[model samples]
Target: MKEVVFQASLDGNCLFLNPAWETITGYSVAESQGRQLLDFVREDDRPCIQTYLEQVKTGKQSSDHPVIRLSHKMGSFRFVEIFVWQTLNKHQQVNGLSGTLIDITDRRQAEAALRESEERFRQIADNMEEMFWIRDLRERKFLYINSAYEAFSGLSPQPLFSDENAFLDFVFEPDRDTVLRVFQEVEQSLSYQFRARHRDGSWRWLRVRAFSIQEGGSPSRRIGISADITSILEREQILEVSLKKEQELNALKSQFIATASHEFKTPLTAISSSVELVRYYLNREPQTPFTAVLTKHLNAISDRTTGLDELIMDTLTLSKLDEGKIQVCFQEVDLVALVEQVIVANFTNREDSRQVAVSVLGDPVWVTIDVKLMSHVLTNLLSNAFKFSSTNPGLVIEFSEHAVRLVVTDQGIGIPEKDRAYLFGKFFRASNVHQIKGTGLGLAICKEYVELMQGYLGVDSTEGIGTMFTITFEK
Candidate 1:
């Protein structure tokens, strides 16, 4: 009877009777003896209490572990584990049941919290992109792997616990030795990088970081993470290749410029000597037909000299652009009149006069620009167009108010698509255009000048369909 007092019962009419029950509920025996037990059971706990009592009355045992409710006098809830067992009469007939209740509120709450923490950690590991792994160094096998590893490798690492070499087999052939060496060093180190072959037959750069876990009397274990660094590795390779190519291109440009300068000097000296001879003859000429012939030769010499001068100037401009020496000064000017003047200056030759026709479009309006550089740009484009279109008569030049455009369209021969990329590169000539007399510096110089003046220059051409060189200067 004394042990039975540790349990409590409320009959159909709700009466709490027992010294131990009073002690557990923080109520005097007198206060609980005739009061409804529902008064002690929290409202939220009444349903479970009723269900449990009903189960006991139906010859069923109350196996529910524990529940919580406030004590009447203590004013705080306490956990109680309730267990019911049937008692027998002396004659071995059926009898009412008795129950044992123990306090377990604190222990149950701790267990629930631990479960929630574990679930949260699992969710984090599963959703992460980086491969996470844990291994027992003593056993030399994987103990755990995150979902990311399984997806990345195409094979779950969980089975690798029995075969320590499984991970080694997945390393790329070129990086296998390095990875093995790194692993050997990891016993003393904590991190390394290597390449691993992915399931898609490509390789990924992987950075691995690990720490050793020491357990008392047991071998040390290792926890590691592997991150994919393929994009970083690719960018590094691309940068290296680009740097090497730029160096080679720079060297090539220097050599080409040196050769072009030497080539231009010879032509320039011949033209200068021819000009001096013409001046000497003109000083004593009696205006004879022979004098006119000499004058024509002098004009030819002058044209050749002008061509050589332009070539030299183009080379010098490109060199300056390469060295970042050119500066632009923006000012308002009549772009239409500027284009007309450049065309007149460049169209002086009989061949140019007979072959190309010049035209203007739109109203003449003042526009902001660097006049000197813009004139150079327009002259180069018109000269190139006329030079290429020498066989085709009536090549036209066009202009507008809001924009100053020069179209030097040639019908002689056209550029190929593959050669377009190198069109603006110094000393680069299309395969078809190589036969045409040119230093190939004209367009490159034009690009630099146009860009310096904040204008746009481009070309359009097709094989056998002729070519059009266009320059649009901002107003």
Candidate 2:
């Protein structure tokens, strides 16, 4: 037996102690022979042991009492349940006591640890943010849910167990069919995400995941967790709507700019031809009154009109680029000659133009490129140089059968460091260039044009010093 049985004489001296006692106390029969029973008890428990012995001897109690701690040879206490009866002599007078002692130390400690573990589990489950549940899959019933279910559903868990299918009523009707379909399948795992109708007439999005517990390959139970995701869903919906509206607005803006630019180009052409004709007449009569004044005013008109015309054309180019409407037809052309013509026309049109020093590395270098787009790229780069540079700027054209580079460098006020990253973005202007008369679309259009020919456009600049624009086309 696991019980430690022992007997003591009326004087409280040990008369017999069993093998289990030796095993428990680490004291053999020879060592415990002459010792009193109280000798093995701890000092603090000695009084209790003495009192219990007195009660048993006087017949005040028997068979059961509160546990007492006894000392083991290892110096640790062992709790034991002791039952004692009065031993009788042949004359029916009380002699010594015979008792049964059961060591309950392991049992007590195990009970304490179990209580602590259960409390910890309860605390975690009760305070959990996510809903934890266990359900009988075949019976279609919820067997367990934590306290969190009350806060989520605004109902106590007890009523949920009173009737099965209570969870179905919380699910929105539109989502019920899908939920039913998912649960109907005998799968090992199931997950559901949908809106569930809340108690207050509002809908809450819930994400539920479960794994089926099976017996003999048949569905038996399910363990599931659910979390509320309403706030996340609402935020995503708002962002989607905002993105759709922004895209629509950008499309309308592009169409408007394209139409307006197309309308402006016709009048701009007429004004340029009329200005040329007036200049032709004035030049023939060089001795005419206020001849210089007439020339200056006419030139001012021409410059302003040309600036307006360029802005409109830049806007139109940006619109077409946005719509991917630019056609790139590759044809062989003398790119060196084409660049020279662009520079000459730009300089000839300006009354007070900066001198552009040109260097050609090869004679009549032929390349395959889109003629119109390349013309725009050269014009934009040279115009930017002429407008910003204070002295002679250099334009170098280097070409070969496999590669071509057109580099334009100027001693102009360079782009600010902060603006360099956004320089090619549409309608983005440098912080320092606010006073310059520009629509901020020139570099953007130039970049798109170069990219259309499968070429690269890059800029090197230091603030307040100088800037260089490089366009390279490679086969």
**Whole-model Cα lDDT of every candidate shown, in order:** 0.71, 0.83
Compared with the true structure, what per-residue lDDT tens digits does model 2 show for residues 398-468? 87677789999989898999889999998898898887878889899889889888899999999888899
Alpha-carbon deviation at 278 in model 2, angstroms: 5.2
Clashes of 2: 0
Candidate 1 lDDT over 1-475, as tens digits, reads 2221322333533233456665566777776655655567778888886677667667674455446463558677666656654456798654544565566666878999999998998898889899987777776777778898778878768567788667887887888887777665435347778888787878888998887776885447877889998998889999999989987897688667877877888878887887988688696868888888878888877877876776787776676687677888889887667766776776666643453565656655677778888887766666666666646423343455466666667775678889988998888989887656787887888787887777788888887877887777755
**lDDT of predicted model 2:** 0.83
Top TM-score model:
2
User: What TM-score should be assigned to candidate 1?
Assistant: 0.45
- lDDT value for candidate 1? 0.71
The best candidate by lDDT is 2
Residue ranges of candidate 2 with Cα displaced over 4 Å: 1-121, 128-130, 136-143, 173-177, 184-189, 193-197, 201-205, 211-221, 228-244, 273-306, 313-428, 442-475
Clashing residue pairs in candidate 2 (N, C-alpha, C atoms within 3 angstroms): none
**Clashing pairs in model 1, backbone N/Cα/C closer than 3 A:** none
RMSD of each: 12.8, 8.8
